[model samples]
Target: MRVLIVEDDAALAERLAALLGEAGLVAETVGDGREAAYLGCTEDYDAAVLDLGLPQLDGISVLRHWREAGRVFPVLILTGRGRWSDKLAGFGAGADDYLTKPFQHEEVVLRIKALLRRAGGHADPVLQAGDLSYDTFAGRFSLHGEPLALTAQEHRILAYLMHRKGAVVSRAEIGEHVYARDLEPDSNTVDVLVGRIRRKLPPGLLVTERGLGFRLVSEPEFRD
Candidate 1:
């Protein structure tokens, strides 16, 4: 999943990005709230970690603007204020959850996971495709009930693909969802990752459309 972190604290934003990355999620940060708001509305992110205090534009207004524009992705408000009014305003403005600052990092991760599950219409965190089953919270992929070993990059690619199952995802689209903004899309890393997935997954799990992109098939192929 790709997440947008809106916070002016450079250190804190980077720390959050790293934490999300380690959890098999892609993240990008914007120190300015206006740019953050622009990206939140323009780009596709599974969720966001938005701070109440921000320069250029306050986080609350940003959230309100997104709601006004009908952008429905789940957003978790992060702020130092723990008052009831603060939380009420956040939810009233369309936030799915709230988190206080100086909080445990794992708490933020957990909240995001909940939002992802609810947003995807998944009653449980487990996602299944054919012979593959993935634990969204555990970030593990299993085939035929046996856990499959995958590199971090492979895991992220597969998770994103599973979420968009049946849709053709281009190389650029995959790169955008799986890697941070700093990573170059021109690199062959994406191709290599897909190749590795083909090797790891059951045959026919993934198929490529020349000049189109790639899609995930939930049914395994049988040989005659």
Candidate 2:
């Protein structure tokens, strides 16, 4: 899964990204609130870490705008403001959870994991679809109670697809979330990767719509 980190403090953002990476999450960091707001609205992040004191726009405004735009992904507020009123305002602005600064890194990770689980409709820490199970914390996938071997790219692709289970995700959307900001991806890389992933998955688990994109479904689909 991928998460967006919006913090003006470059050090903190990078640190959080590193921590998220170690925890099996792909993290995209943006130091500007306006940019964060834009990405938060446009990107398909599993969750987001938003700082209240942002440069261009405050975190509350960003959250409000994202909510207004129908961005339903979970957002956790990370801020130095400890006042109860601050938290109340954040909740009012549509933040799912709040964390004051100087908190534990473990807490942050746990909060994000909780948000991810809820967002994916998972009642447990492990994300499961039928016989397919993925341990989000370990970045390991299991099929029919056996470990499924997958390359890093393949795992990332599968994780994203599983998170958006029934939605038709385009190759472009997959690329945006799977690839790093500095890496230049080939036009058909996602397609190739999806084909590779499909080989390992059970037949009919992954489907491609002629002109749209790919989707991970719980059952087989009827072809014309």
The local distance difference test score of each candidate is 0.86, 0.85
Alpha-carbon RMSD, candidate 1: 2.4
lDDT of 1 by residue, 30-144 (tens): 8998998899888877789999999999989999999898899899999999999999999999999998878998888878877887776767788877889988888788998
TM-score of each: 0.87, 0.85
Report how far residue 39 has shifted in candidate 1, in Å: 2.5
* lDDT score at residue 84, model 2, on the 0-100 scale: 98
Model 1 C-alpha lDDT versus the unseen true structure: 0.86
Clashing pairs in 2: none
Stretches off by above 4 angstroms in model 1 are: 187-189, 221-224
Report the C-alpha lDDT of model 2 over 1-224, residue by residue, as the tens digit: 77899999999999999988877778889988789888887776778999999999999999999999999889999999999999999999999999998998767887897888778787767877667888866667999999999887788889888877888998777877776655636758878889998888888889998789998987756577
Pick out the ten consecutive residues of candidate 2 with the lowest summed lDDT.
178-187
In candidate 2, position 189 carries an lDDT of 83
